[model samples]
Target: MGFGHIPFDVSHALAGGMLLMSFVLLYQRRVPGLIAALATQGGLLGLAALWQGWAQGAAGLYLTGLIALVAKAVLIPWALSTLVRRLGMHGSVQTALGIGPSMIAGVGLAALALVVALPVAAGGSALAQEDLAVALSVVLLGMLVMIARRNAIGQVVGLMSMENGLILAAVGVQGLPLLIELSTAALLLVLALVAGVFLTGIRERFDSLDVAFLEDHRGERR
Candidate 1:
């Protein structure tokens, strides 16, 4: 009824894939590429949950996986793509930091995550500890993505990516209630829809999705 029943390598592989996708998100420049990377991360997250469910005999994790697949992997990405197309934002991403610098920062953040996670998870299983470390790194990287990007769509993608890390950490642990997981997923869906609507309004008003524009408008009003 625990990860002890499953091969550690399998869970590691799935979680590792999710961490790798976070790095990919850091490297992406174009809108379409960013959406694709997010979708791929969602898929990896679903697989990780599925393996965890099987390992822990938690049927709830399977449902979490399904939700992630359908909502995150398919629905959210499709919506984002449509939004990008309609808004004519099919261009390179604008970042506040260069790729090399961002990546170096990401690596430093990742190391910090490991350092923090190991001590915190000292009482937990090795698998859980590793998963938590990776999850922490993903969360930090996702935040970096949000802070580093100027595009509205890129920021939204980063927000969702951070949520993915939370889900990963939740599923990695045993005995966590399924209700919490479902609620978290539902909240994210609401967040995505709300963000999309908000972005549309912003674009219509200012004719630009750059947050800097909004700040400039506010400054002019003031």
Candidate 2:
């Protein structure tokens, strides 16, 4: 079963929200603000999932929705807050490129994704295949943010954004399998735990978290 009332509208709105969050992520330079944005994006994802659950009457979806809300939305930010504190990071941001250029490129990317999506999607409901396009755009943009940024934290945020986009795409596919989500979540948590330990150890060894310094270390080794 699909969404009951406004399945088309609801799906498009969810896809649009994902795209909007992608744009927001492109320009965010502050760590805290970026984390906040991640949480906000996660909340929107939960809303989208909840809408799907209501429309489809799937009880399991509630678990997925809750995970999006509580784990991605709340727990991640809380963990980041604690991690940043331990690192004594007053303020850190990677500024290797101007924000203006990045925004322009991001817009171009969205346009490209939309254009490319049209031909492949034969035709169907309002968001039948367009949701896939939007999902792909968000994933690509998140990757760009991760690659272009000079901050470790920003890259982490970008990674999380990409993960959320993946989830959004799956949810739009009607009855996507569930076992993978639970398994992936467990692994992701472990990744975060390892990341936290690495962050602390890196700071202790190098006495800094700046990407430039880390690059220099790598250069010296080579």
Q: What lDDT score goes with residue 133 in model 2?
A: 83
Per-candidate TM vs. native?
A: 0.95, 0.88
lDDT of 2 at 188: 67
Question: What would you estimate as the lDDT of candidate 2?
Answer: 0.77
Q: At residue 188, give the lDDT of candidate 1.
A: 95
Q: How much is 204 displaced in model 2, in angstroms?
A: 1.7
Leading candidate by TM-score: 1
Among the numbered candidates, top lDDT falls to 1
lDDT of 2 by residue, 1-98 (tens): 23554776776787788788788888887778788888888888888888777777876677788888998889987898788877777664766667
